[model samples]
Target: MDFIPEALNKKPEVLLIYTQRMIRGRTFEMIENLGILTLAAQLNANGFEAKAYTGITTDAVKTIKNMKDRLFAVCFYCDFDNQSAVAAIISYLKKHYHFYVVLGGPQTLHMTEKDLGSFQADGILKGEGEETLLTWLNAKIRGEAVLVPGEIQPAQNADYIYLEDFSKYALPRNEDVLDYHERPLLSVITARGCPYRCAFCFEGGNSKNLRMRTAKDVLDEIEARLKRSQRPRYLFFCDDTFTTNPVRLRKILSGVKRLREKYDFVWFCEGHPGFLVKHLEFIREMIDSGMVRMQIGMESGVDDVLKAYGKQASPEDIKKVVEICYAAGLPQLTGNYIIGGAFETAETLATTTRKALELLDLAPGMLDLSTTFIMPLPGTQIYNQPEKFGIVLEDRECLTNLEDFPVNHTKELSLPEVCMGRSRFITAVSNKMKEQYEHGLITKERIQADFKLAFNYGIAAGYLKFIYGKNNLMVEYYKKLIDYQGLLKEWHELSEQEKNTWVIQRIPDFSLFDINTLSQLEIDILAGAGSDTIGETAEKLSLSAEKIGVLLKGLSDRYFVLFSPFI
Candidate 1:
């Protein structure tokens, strides 16, 4: 450890700020920011006073003023959505404070040296912030700064700051890092870096070396968090590929299974498509181990487009993997799709939409389609050499809007054109939703309920499953229909004639559920539910209020009925 002057302080002090451009107006749970917490953990283990806060949740300058300890540096973790907002905060802090200001995160990984000046921060560390950040901080304190005074540089192997023993730094003291007052989910990154090389991914070019923590270590962290009264009902594995290594994933999940028997929580994780096809059988073990949701990187469903993106699977294989998972009792599957690939064209777009729509037909509420236009971040292969990927950077600064940028990941179609194509795709999906509604898949009450709430039913389903068991079929039912934003907009466009209470009876398709499995009273409840609320059914059928409420709730849980607005 290096010596510091007594005038500065007895110990080096630093402040980590996790600032976001969004989340100010929205109701959200406080999340455990793993990136900043890990760095804070490293600082604390070595003798440094570190504090952190979200700029949106609390004021940055006020945090500085209220701190009892003096500070040497202030670091801001940036999200891609809030790049401009974070930059503004950095400039304001620089004007108001004397400490060194630095920015690091996913957004920084995409910026080059020329772009660093635009941020206006004192220094920007251009890679993973662990070892590089510590060395940069320690050297600055020792008056032997790594770069020429106030100069920003890219991270290189010669920095000699990598954490060789990753296990020591993997866990952080939650109190020192984040507040989990209302947040019921804890994000755990069991590993760092991705192995596959997908051209459009930032991890492909930036995060090179993959490091992992053992299964025992992960279970220990969960137990510790549980003891702290921050009982997380869900665990989101925030790794680039949580299911990359078969052996490691098995051990980790086995431990997770044991923990779930006591604490009771399900989890969500993202994986490469190749991995899913390779371990088709193991998916059951994943589901049985309390994995409710699986997100696959299915950027494009067309085989040709997938090939161009360097993804390993074909269109058939993509379809095959999802079919396998759904067959193995996986309740929900989310496939990510991008409209404007480097090789995107009208034909390929049609095929991709058709593929997604077909899967939606097969899985109904069990499948979620996450569709969007591709963002060409600076360090990506597409951004570095635009012509090579059929992209045109009309104005790189206009990144906040998809339509205003003028280029949409490909020179073949302008950004607005891409937006229009995405709009049409959404309209098509909305039509599919209407089709499902017409097919007796859902009750009129659910349709009325969704339209009223702007269709935000997916989030509630997960929490509902905690109260109702994972086996409850209704909680696994309809996600806020695919393209919910577009669906909301479509509702706004609807004339009074199109909007509801203009009800055609959403008579339950009795063939969909097994009547034999239901009891005589439960069967009578469904028969009485037509065009009538549960209250009305109870009165007309002369059923007791308690019997009606219990039976109705049970039916709703089993997917035989919906008790949305009408009831």
Candidate 2:
């Protein structure tokens, strides 16, 4: 997203806000504003100061107000989930704060002139922004004509700029702006762009060009990430297709193997089935390089659906990739499956579900999956030309829905039918994945590792919902929610006065129940909670332990209080 003005103050500091949209019940999977962090690192390298914040627009407005006049231009990584909030933030900041507002991210790749005006942002940066943002801002700082990266002409209509040499900027992941000591989003972007244009992927707008950082640079980053932390770290390769280039991949694996000898860490990456199959020899090397897990884009197990979606891999490739990873002794291999896509039929959906379960059965403990309803995000092939994919869009507004539901239906499947099919598919897969633990397939150590990983930065991963189903780490927590031997203590952050006067209605949403509010009794119980076990606290309150045990469990789940047996 980009249009830069040729005038601005040279006061070095910039603010990049990643506006979050909350859907009452569900939270985002992302623990941090990764894109904003990448841009912040870029600015730091260019002799400018920047900080990244992820919050609702209201919280963002307060952050800007706190900065007062230091903010000459505030940038945002605007996205589909919160467009209205971003637009409102831009309009208000421009009106009252009186600073230049720049927007970028997935939404900008598809925004038009009218959309830009409505957003009230000075410019929308399209495609990659690491280089463009710096170029545009630097030119404005020097009072030179602002332009796109590598372009001789002034920036015009929606532009797509790739950082040509991805190594031109700093490591895309930055920990300076992040205070997270445990999980600093140890994600690395060894490369950018995908060569394949899958019909539903936003990468289609990325211009189908692949640019890679040098192997030494990527290796240096992995070592840098592992150097300071003593605990086991999980690094995620954020590249869409980490296995795209085989020779480079081999070098990466070799570097990671060397690093593992000195650092306690494991890593995961998104893999392309087609590439993995072609370079099948690398699977063992990847696992040997501390690669414990892999995420695959097995959109469907039906070849017809895969073909219609323009995915390069066939169902055979998906099966082969899973078997290769599992047989190579890869501990875990999870793939993504689309339930309600353009060409989905009952038979195709069943094929995906049945075959997916069969794959899991084949590997038993090693294979798993996540299923999502197909939503045509803007700029994707289906969004641009639904007719081409034989999809009919019905509820356009559902595009921003945090919960997955069918928004479009094919000629063969009605909206309701698609919805039902998706529900069935998810239920079946989630159940099978659960058995990975219940039947002693997936281990408690892994589930615990994943659990800690989800909240490493103090926010739940979207997969928290699934964590409960796997039912491993929580067993002890549940057993001790009111364990008479354990004590109940308020989260240190809650003030004494808050406990004294706050009513049940005054409490904010709980992790357990944004839907269920605290009852008056629950409030009293919270106020009285302390180092004393609930059995003792109940006696003090003249209430039965069971009466308030469940309530305290809810409060404890939200971290309102730490009901021991948990950290």
Candidate 3:
């Protein structure tokens, strides 16, 4: 259904706020602004004046207050980097603004109505918020009692609350409300939910039920995005597994090719080894269709560690998949490795480290090492059996911030050993990979830079091992910086032919934006384009000279458009 923007009389005022890391921070390179923007579009279509307020500082909120009169406010809270900032906003809205504040997202889904009351939210939209939020808002527009589907119907006597399917309703124009500031990338969600069970995981721990969109449905979304967005340059498929079924993956790859021929975009998504080997041909097709990268969840290379985490695939399975991806020209692949999970001992951790080294040497892409500590979430099996895992249940305060606690402790290894091992492995493998790449051991520069990042990352890993153990900011920072550096080096080194081998390399992911937030420009220089004159690009894009000047200045600062020649 086409969403018509209703005026003040016809529509109810709806304000959507996204104060999470996606809008505010630079630590994570994400695609979707979670589901907040998508829910906002749904509200807008249902005769609600929806506007997204992101990374709103105190001054920014004051300015927004002056701009729009509010009726209801919605905030998506997913354990954001800045919870205090978002909590303050929520507090302000309820106490001063007198707005009906609805908190939705992963954090809300984890907490019951009582647990979420601490956030001071009037109501929490559990599960998928699209239908529930829209229903609640539409009812509010008519001055009806706000009741969310499967919402723990506020009652005197209730044993348990059953969640409802909010996905069945007409999804909002997520593409419409998605304000990219005319950036190069477009966020694409091909499917929802995962099929695996990883005990430490909080996102998919709630359920292992995989739900996919029809190939046609996904292709339609791509086509719509190609027409509506900035040429559909880059797509980040938010699906947990993009290659679960070979036949479906093949069909989607075929569709992606059809779209790529016209729109010319690249995409990336997460996958597992079990799916990759079964769909080798589709993997190749994915590469041909501009699928540049795969974020494979190779939690641990040790067979024992794999079994402990309920990862069905073994080290051999991962090796085979990584090798296949390399052959298919999917050169930028990253693996997620968990360090401090239940049943993880010092010896098992060492085996994981050694396994990572072995895999890094054999694989072709960049390997991202994630060393996450296991945390008991609300619905996961680990939460029910804390004693079985040797976790101290009495220490509730430790569990409050997952970053500070080690949820799983085994007798074989001290907490520090498990944590330090993760740091050591992340550092060692990363630096070794990069050092080999820098020394011309790898033919692909992108692959080389990916490894090169590990060198700098090792320094951070060393620090993490000393200070904050696993999943520390220093470790993460090292990984990100190394990745960025590697990306830049790859961007500079890859030839047009080599670059064309993968979809990600064909199109640029980063963009040039002005300080005023009024303008955004494609900073990606076309093949053979000289850096002699910035004015030429301004003319090509039909942009004003002033705008072009601003863009060039920004690009230069960001090192996107460099003046230096290759030695």
Candidate 4:
């Protein structure tokens, strides 16, 4: 009656290594290395003693050293940013241990044998690794020769293996490998591969086919996970496009609604604007089914830019979808934007900024915006044929380094120009929000939440600037905000006109200045600065002399304004 295989206890062990990477200063998504955990689960099910080390503790080397004799294979779930770490680990294993080393994941797909040689790994698993890994391990266990697609050695059996039905594989359990006992969020994948061809996306562009699990299968997995975690805080659907198939999505929502009645949990998923608009009722159903948030990839707000990037929806489509979601009473909506893409010009960037502002205006307190420069990942059209997009690739090694913006030059803009443009766009959005706050359009609580979101963007843009060899003005501004909290509080207490003069005199760079600091009255005051006296300047601008005198005194103290001593 025992489920454990007798052979597994006797077989040599396998070690799966997963290193963490940060995205947008958030590690919530990376907490569980799902791919490796799924591989380990399959290995265990197939009568192999597999253990995983998720870099939670620095015991990988000690574990490997202790089990050197029993360790048969060392598998690494590689990431673009962790190439050096992977190489270091592989080199150490090769130098001391004799186990077969296997490299897999998106990073392996783009690397050549020469590029991989330094790591001294025995083989690499290209494409989906589940079936290939299970097949190779089974062959190895059976004392038969195995061949990997990109390896130097060839086996007698060279056929590739892929799981036709995704449901056959067991759902990954995060508690098995990840330190998820205390974590509130758990990520689950309902599907594999994306059908769309996004030029800036390596994953979607390289996805040969779309494969999905049935609603029953997904719901069963969710129910099991909830039972294990005792209903975790949130369930994140990590599918590339959760609503790509409306029929399947509706079925899934119905099952989720049934589950929600029994469990106290909320869920989040990613969706496209086209699908969101097409399936309005489904979105409402999802919200009713405890779907708290949906992240939409509205890549750009310019129609031409979206078309050039092969996006399915236009700016109008995105706005309409946002309006629909608002009408549907969705709790929170997050929109992702890519700034520098093919055919992007100053006018297009402005149009995009304006459109993004319009979206913000639509959902003043509900919308969360994330903006970034387009990265040309390997295997994408932009990467394979850079000349077509007028892109000049720089630092191929850094393609996977998403923390800092990757280096590339478009025909229309250089890397620095792109970085600056991205910063300006984010600043513009922040200013608009600030303006709303100043005019009493939005609550202080809303402004504070908006500031937090804008701060994250500032940190990202500042890192990008540092990468692009520009002064990290955004970073400095962030420091100023933290260091000058008292000064800012005092500045906020000043009348709207005084605050404007303070900002204009202190922060001369318009791009860096918060536009909300400048009111129409302040603009008029500046326009009438050539008058002989404060009274005349105030009269000219239709403002009181007392107000002008206060602004003039503040500016003079900062050496920004001067008065005629003879007068």
Task: Quote each prediction's TM-score.
Answer: 0.72, 0.74, 0.70, 0.71
- TM-score for candidate 1: 0.72
Sorting all predicted structures by lDDT, with the top scorer first, yields 2, 4, 1, 3
lDDT scores in order: 0.63, 0.67, 0.57, 0.65
Name the lDDT value of residue 182 in candidate 3: 52
Please provide the root mean square deviation of candidate 1 (C-alpha atoms, Å): 10.7
What are the root-mean-square deviations of the candidates from the true structure over C-alphas? 10.7, 11.1, 12.6, 12.1
Clashing pairs in 1: 390-411
Write one digit per residue (lDDT tens) for candidate 4, span 96-166: 76678888767766666564566678776765676777777777666687655534333222222334587
A best-first ranking of the candidates according to their TM-score comes to: 2, 1, 4, 3
* 2 versus 3: better TM-score goes to: 2
Winner by TM-score:
2
Candidate 2 lDDT, 196-309, residue by residue in tens? 888888775445577777789899877876776666677778877688878888889998898889976778888888888888898888888877778888888888778988
Worst 10 contiguous positions by lDDT, candidate 4: 459-468
Given candidate 2, what's the lDDT at residue 407? 77
The superposed Cα distance between candidate 4 and the true structure at residue 471, in angstroms, equals: 30
**Candidate 2 local distance difference test against the native:** 0.67
Candidate 3 whole-model C-alpha lDDT, 0 to 1? 0.57
Cand. 4 TM to true fold: 0.71
